[model samples]
Target: PGKDKGKDMILLTKMDKRPPNWTFVFAVDVARSGSVSADYSVAIGIAYNSISQEKQICYFWRSKGLKISEQAEEIAEISKNFNHPYLLVEQNNMGQDMIDELTDKYNVNVEAITTGAHTTGKNIKKEELIRFLISAFEHEKITIPRGDEYSREQMSILEDELTKFCAIPTPAGNELFQGVGAHDDCVIALALANRATQTVGIPFAVTLGPGRTQAGGVYSALLQATRGESDIEKMIKLGIIK
Candidate 1:
């Protein structure tokens, strides 16, 4: 089912124009019952690409579990068409199983980026990521692929969820959707992936032996601080401090 070369070519062209070094993280969900008529056996797919100057361009897609095979094929096709080097995936709940199935069956190369020991908590990290995503969306930095009605609807739902996902008075009042089971894991995963991509920088270079490495700018410095990779002393040493 991969005959749509025209559209794929357009996307691939755009991908090529992006930074040569970039990370594409995709988070996908599949239904447990494998039911077709259910509320989408497959939930959503978040594609995040790291760009230069510590920016990440994100794309969100939604589909049914029954169509995951085709959707994954398209995603893989896009990755291969554009020559993306990495695919960072979030391994939580059924995420790992679905990704594993893709790897084993479709031969898609994906890696799991572990969430380090959280000093604050996973929830806090999730919230921070959400905030960043919201800002990115507001600034029109994130793009949703066209012609996908499901993804369009999910984006609307996400907008509503964000509106209600602010600090409140009661302990449970602050929860999105009154603490219902509508977990924002997909959104949170996307945000974390974007953050990770930004920390490493697009076109990330691995210095075998450090001589004269061109460090990223302020945004990278801030992201490094958030990831606990830099301190005041290091910033000063890097010539970022006065």
Candidate 2:
């Protein structure tokens, strides 16, 4: 969306239709600063047909100032509208309040994550979360709305954050992914949605081409995707899956 942005595929492929076998899931990233102060973002990802579980549907909700109950109302509607999506809310800071609002008040069976490591039960770092999404992109296994307004609004935020997203090797040899002066609420939500997709596997398997292993290749694949195409159609043309 900016100068020379498509040169390296800095964005992901965008699509419209969800495959017939896809199932939806919801994820939320609650702000820690204040219930209504910091950014609150949620995204829905659809796990399309295959064992690899490519995410082909992405819808986003984001706002700066909103009470937990207000957010819960919107989430409830989103869940109901999306076939009762499994909700995963980040359980840090005011997030517990959000869960209480959704579960106790809204009657949503929402799941909670203490941190990025909470999902897989193995101390999975936030770095792994960021890298997981990136790896999905590198393997050409993720999709987003092509030009839909609400979806684009969320993808725009996600892309802006991704630009500042980076990793550095620490003295302890652990890699950390962080955005400078930016937040990854949407990105983490998207990642969580995709992880949920992995668990609800479909019957078929998607055969991916050799992944873009090099950084440059990965960037090219991430940013250079087939536009105005459906997921299976796009992958077929890109030679990623057949």
Candidate 3:
């Protein structure tokens, strides 16, 4: 399907309320494709609990109809409306176009990261990012939302994309990971999000003033809402509280 990247190409999904110490980050693995040759998505994730570091949300914005610049504007708007996430853009190939639009034209807050020396000294490696994502899912450090009335039906589509990831052998005798389907924009973008949040350090919750204490009365309820129907306490029951 040749979808047009127009104003109509947008995504809306319900997200949980940000917790006290939630570190919000937005990452982009940019691509320009009018058809299904490739796909691009804007992914959002939140990391909490500085000690344990649990990722609470995994949401994506992708459309075949919208141009890269259009997608950049959409991501900027979403980030601004939802607590201004720390933006990360991969400047490889056509990715620079997305970076230019977000920084030069829109003048938004964004950080550009590339593989190898581009992310030098920061110890941010693509392999590490992918490993972190895999670990998050396997170890139950990441929890995905089931969406709500706004995107109840479309949420599964996004989640389905995650299942298509495959690892292939590279000429260098190392395994390269990617989506085997026409597009793996969601997986790549989410990996970037995890990397961004990881390198930036976990945001800690601070009080307003002296003697002021943070409220935990509704924390559990918020987690329930974020975790959907999952028994979040199972992790605690298993003595995995870190």
Give the best candidate by TM-score: 2
Please identify which of the two predictions, 2 or 3, would achieve the higher TM-score against the true structure.
2
TM-score of 1: 0.48
The C-alpha TM-scores of every prediction are: 0.48, 0.69, 0.66
lDDT of each: 0.42, 0.58, 0.57
Residue-level lDDT tens digits of model 1 in 1-242: 12221122111222434444544444443433345554332223333444423333344444554554565565566456535434555455445665676687767766654333232433223334444454344333444332345434555554443333432234654322121225444445455544455444543333222121233456445535643222322332443321
Model 2: lDDT of residue 197: 57
TM-score of 3: 0.66
Which residue window of length 10 is worst by lDDT in model 2?
203-212
User: Root-mean-square deviation of each candidate, in angstroms?
Assistant: 12.1, 8.8, 12.2
Q: For residue 83, what is the lDDT in candidate 1?
A: 56
TM-score of 2: 0.69
For candidate 3, write residues 68-100 as lDDT tens digits: 767778877767665666788877666778878
Show pairs that collide, candidate 1: 21-203, 42-65
lDDT of 1: 0.42
| Residue pairs with clashing backbones, model 3 | 3-65, 4-65, 5-65, 5-66
